[model samples]
Target: MEQLLYITIGGSTHTATMVSNAATEALLTRLKSSPVTVTLNSSGGFEIWGALGFSLPATDEPVNAQPGDIVLYNGSNICMFYGTNSWSYTRLGKIDGLSESELRTFLKAGESNVKVTLSLSNTAGLQSVDGSVAKSNGSAYTLSGTSACAGQKGVCIKNKKKIIR
Candidate 1:
């Protein structure tokens, strides 16, 4: 595919954790109840690609279900071979970072169906009982929508529990 289908975080820093958690919840809500999965990959690092995928709801239902898109985080195996560790190697580049213009575009496009998922190497982004970005809105800030999440409409799957904030 031309895009990456996964979201991966490399560090346990505060900013990284917040973004990682928010991104994952935002993406999962966009998935529209699709089956979720995770895997481990050992990349060599010749390439790194990021993409946002979308799928519309099969039926028109008001349940906060809309056509949304997902922002995928990716890295190449080639980078893993470099001196850098997995965290630095997998962290997205300028093109995939929050500052990229595509961030908004991806969210807007995926507002209907794409559920965002994030894979973190550390616990930086874990949320409390209340839905809030643990860290300040640094490079990114997400707009709220129709999902169970109040600030945002997507559901968050953390610690293996499905919670919609």
Candidate 2:
């Protein structure tokens, strides 16, 4: 629920300036400050996005991700970087409770519902998982993924409480 902005990237373009730019853009947006030299702590790897692969916009008129290159969100961890778009929300921490099976089912269901909510609703802005989850305390649990949500590592949660009821 606490929405924090962090940079995320893959191994494919570590050396590429574009990768740096993407990170820069994310940081700038998240940090909302003038650009400056920044040091990043990262675990290296390569991943691609989109059906074709690449997530970078084409330099030419064709604005789409190229094949083999994965699309990246500005603030997510890698892997399921973008549940739908190049951006997603993420949170991380030591899970305090909930059995493994319960956690699994919660995440699976939450991910599915989140995707549907995202697609159907105009949720273009970043939302506080911690804030929302906090409100639903005891109703939800976290599912952690090594991958990025826009490029940051953290926990994903499955809320057990039924809001619909």
Encode model 1's per-residue lDDT on 1-165: one tens digit a residue.
122223322211111222233344454364444423232232232222233333222221122111122223331111111112223222221223343233334333212222333433212233342334322322222212111224533454333344445
| Candidate 1 segments whose C-alpha is farther than 4 A from its true place | 1-30, 47-95, 98-126, 129-165
Best by TM-score: 1
Give the Cα error of residue 50 in candidate 2, in Å.
9.5
Off-target runs (Cα >4 Å) in candidate 2 are 1-19, 23-110, 115-165
lDDT of 1: 0.28
lDDT of 2 by residue, 90-128 (tens): 211111233444323322322321221111111222244
What C-alpha lDDT, on a 0 to 100 scale, does residue 85 get in candidate 1?
A: 22
Clashes of 2: 32
